[model samples]
Target: MPTFTINGISATVPDGTTILAAAIRIGVEIPHYCYHPKLSIAGNCRMCLVEVEKFPKLQIACNTVVTEGMVVRTDTEKIRKAVTGVLELMLIHHPVDCPICDQAGECGLQNYYMKYGLHKSRYDLEDKVRKKKVQDIGGMIVLDAERCILCSRCIRFLREVSKTCEMEFFQRGDHSEISIFPGRKLDNYYTGNLADICPVGALTNKDFRFKCRVWFLSSFDSVCTGCANGCNVLADFKGDILYRLKPRRNDAVNQTWMCDFGRLEYRKANEARLLVPVLRENGKAAAAAWEGVLSTTALRLRDIADNEGPDAVAVIASPRSSNEELFLAKKLAAEVLKTENIGFTSRTPGDRTSDDFLIKGDKNPNSTGAQLLGITEEGFGRVVKAISDRKIRALLVFGSELSDFPDSQVEALLSNVPFVAQVGTNEGVVSRVANAVLPSASFAERGGTFTNFTGRVQRFSQGFPPRGKAMNEIEILAGLANRMGADWKFDGEASVFRALAASSAPFAGMSYESLGSEGQVVAEGRK
Candidate 1:
């Protein structure tokens, strides 16, 4: 342990901790660039210079390690002058494209310039070095060499984090710029992270560019549903439109980076959305009132349950659904509907699309949550068999698409089933075949928890209102349960989770508040 005084605030930190990190621990701000905690330290950016007692020259805080009884002043005149000089050199040849740059509001260069180097530009605008602007770098990133400060964050990220080594500094001196090797491109699964880690507007996400300004958008913590990894993310949206999904720092899961697949998955929330309740009659689906749709669906299931027993009704939940939704689905089947067959549709059974990183073989985000609630993949085959045998006359599907099941088998099963009720977010093949299509909210439009592959129950909040008449799965289920004479009074997601935690063994001692932004990992045996 080593004791250090950063801006007169004394604290003891472990050996080898940099002055920049130590300063951060005690609420002292040390302005820096190219000092990503996850990436290897490159002392190229001298913006973090600080005045160290007894040291002749101000040292870069990022590379300077704290020693016992060390005194550091981060806001001294010497430190300010050094930081101003560094920032002046950084912006010497940089373009004044702040008005057009996508990263204007969040750009590090702009921030530092206003804070440190507020001096008028000594060099003429035409005299500024111009390289490339809006150059199409591979993998959803655009590059502007003129905007780069050459802090090497992107270079180090590629070399260390992604291990791609696609990016490197080319040329020398003021002409030095980031570029990909000849015939190579920045095409990695984690390439979108480069834009995220880049300090300046030099590198920008191609998908997010010109879409919306960062400051105008509202962000809320949510987990990515692209896979079982359950990468924590910030859902950035404006009004009802989700603009992007940025990786939120979750060391145990995604470690400050998310794959491009998951980053772009937010687009699905806006595409092919099922907004209203639809009833299929004579192979045609027409928009119907929510009350009529739910009542008809409930009556059909009740008839099948009363005539052929509860086993005649099969419930197929989605692995992509939240733990609260899956728990309620299980409760509806076991208690209210009184059915033995209750399971979720496995999206990627025996999937091989996994990597050494965040991407998982199981495409479903809440598969572990479903399993925790006693729903398994084995029920998929059993329910399909029951449908084929004509034993299951009624099928209640939650968020499962026809593509989730074998195409031929699902088609055959749907044809045989007397009544099929589907509750989902999007308009898919299953909704077309379903007698009653009830629109349920997408992950972005609802609040619930998703248990990752390792049993971490992470909570996500509603980023926006449900599209059209689409309600959340909990609301849809609660409405259906009430229609069936069940006294289920779930006011919100919290209440439903409370009931789930009280009744379920795996979810015991867990609540929405306990499963905060980073999430809580359930005990191994409890799950």
Candidate 2:
């Protein structure tokens, strides 16, 4: 360990830890750009300058590695003056258009200006650098060279991680700017990551341009439903509308990046979200209140349970649901309905493993969590065989969106069941066969936890209220279990997780509070 003093606070960090990281650890805010934790250090932006004792010049904290007994001062007047001078120089060529810039409230420039900047400018009033309005950087990103701070974070990202090497610095000195070389363009599987690392309005997402101001937008931690890699994400919203998606840092999962496909899934929420519970009457869908829907749904299930016993009812859990929600579904089936034929459904391809990085083969967020709760491929096979026969009479299907399954096997299996109750965010094939249908909230509208491909459980809060009368899946399951006379005692997902960790073998030692940012995996040794 290397011992160092940052702003008079002594601390010990790993030998190679940078001064920026050490300063951050001791509550000193060092303004920085081009110093993303995941990306290689590009000491171009000199914004994280700090004064060190016995070292005359300002040091870039990002590239300055901590040494034994080193003393650093992050808040000295000399450091502030140097930082102010750098900010002024950077702002000279930068545009003063925060009103139109997409990165307004959260931009690195805004944060640095507030922390260390002169309220007045001292430039000789030379014409500022004027770049094209919005140069298309491939299909998904737009570039404005005038707004770029020459950080090279985007350029380095292209060269290093994505290995595309499309974006590069052009020319020399003040004429230098970020651009593609020759005929190549900034296009890659991980291109969206550059938009995140740009640190300014230089790179903007075309999908989120002018959609909503960042100040009005709120964020919620979530899991990417685009694939099985189960990348943890921040779902940014403006009131009831979803505006954008950003990758949340989870070292065990997707790390600091997400695919472009995952970023576009935010648009899906605005379309096809069921806002109310619909019951089929006279072969047409009709809206019904919660009291009416619950009573009718319970009566149908109770009659089936009484006549055909627990063997008659089956619950098909969705992998899109949370571990807490799925556990409640399993409990609803085995305990309340007393049916051993409970199974989870997904159109997951045969390969259900993970690569060295993100993108798990499972293709659903909580398959590991579901498997931990005792649901398995073989268990699903048993449910399929029983339903194929005339054994199971009723089915409760959750999250039946065809986009999730997109296969014929699940549809064929659902065809054999006589009576079905579909609880989901949309009306699908399951709802067509539904004797009673209830609207369940989407992942964005609910508070819950998901165990990603790494088997690390993470809790996400609801960013917006439930769409119309739709309830969270856990709440709906709790209500249904109560109606069916089950021993479900959970008041919410937290209680459900506590019970899950207590009784479930795999998660027996875990709790919700222990899950960290991006639902970092609980390391094997700590427990």
Candidate 3:
């Protein structure tokens, strides 16, 4: 351990900790660029200069490792002068496009200028060097060379993190600017991260460009359900619509990067959503009130369970559902409906589309969670076979579509079943064939836990309300259980999770509050 004093505050930290990191540890703010913790330290940006006791000149805090008895000052007049000089030089040729820039509210250069350099510009606005305004880079990123500060964060991320070396600085001196090769464009699975690390308006996501100001959006810590990796993410929503999904720093899972597929998953929450309940009348699906649909479906299911026996009914749970939703679905089938033909199906397309990075072969995010809840692979096969054999007269599905099953098998199954009730966030093939379609909240609009492929039980909070008449899966299940004469009570996701933890051995001793934003890993044997 090394002892260092940052602004009269003494602290001991491990060796090799940089002065910028040490200052941060002691609540000393050091303005910086090109110093991402996960990316390689490129000390090209001189914004983080700090004064040391015995140093002849200000040292770049990012590359300066702390030493025993080292004293550092970040708020001195000399350091402020140096930082102001650095910012002035960086802003000399930079264009004044803050009014039209997408990163106006969160740009690092704008924030640093307000903090360090609040003086009049020495150069005329007409003298600013003109560069390309908007270049359509591949992989959902737009480049504006005029707003770039040349921090090298995007370049380092492409080279070191994504390993896609498609960009570099061209020319020398003041004329230098970031550009791609003549024929090459920035195209990678993780290319969206370039805009995330750019710090300035130079690089921006094409999908989210000029959609909404960053300050107007409310953010919630959540997890990506694009794959079983369950990468941590921040969901940004405004006016009941999800605007974007950014990767949140979770060193245990996705270090500061997420695949572009997961980053764009928020669009589904805004588009093509199921908003209301529908029921079949005269062979046509029509919108119906929630009370009418729920009461009718409950009566129909009760009749089948009484006359045809519980074995004639089948429940198909989806791997896309959360752990709490899966637990309640299991309880609804086994305890309430008294059916033994309950199982879950995976939505994984194939292993060929998977990569060595965050994208997993298993497309479903909570398959491991479904498995822990006693929903087995063989059980799903048996249920499907029973449906095809015409032994199952009634069917209940959660979040899965008819595409998850074989086309020929599910078509026959759907034709034979007299009553099919489906709950999903989107209107798909299953919902079309189902006699009753109940709209359920999407992952972004619900709060629950998801167990990743490695048995990590991460929890996510609701970012917005469900679309239209859609309800959360937990509430829908609890309503159904109560209608069936069961006394199951659930106020919200937390209460349901507590009850699940109390009943299941794997989830025992775990609570929703205990599973923080970072998540806790369940033991391997339990999985």
Clash counts for all predictions: 0, 1, 0
Q: Model-by-model lDDT, in order?
A: 0.87, 0.78, 0.87
lDDT score for residue 228 of model 3: 90
Residue lDDT tens for model 2, 1-527: 98988878889999899999888777788988878888898888888998877887889999999999999888888888888988998998787888889889879898889878846876555666666668887857889888999999988888778787898888787667888777878767677888888889999998888888888888888878766677778999987788889998877777789878789767756767777877766557788888788777877787898898888887777788888888888877777777787777556444454445565556677777787787765666677788878687887777765334444655676667767778888656667656678888877887778776656777877888887888888878877877777656677777888888888766766777777565545446422
Task: Estimate, for each residue in 354-456, the C-alpha lDDT of model 1 and write its tens digit.
Answer: 7988888888889889988899778877887787888888999887474345656667778888899999987766887899999998889999999998999
Q: Write the per-residue lDDT of candidate 3 for residues 193-261, one digit (tens) a residue.
A: 988998899999998999999899999999998889999998999978999999998898999889888
**TM-score per candidate:** 0.97, 0.91, 0.97
Q: Which ten residues in a row have the lowest lDDT in candidate 2?
A: 518-527
Q: Report the Cα lDDT for candidate 1.
A: 0.87
Better structure of 1 and 2 per TM-score:
1
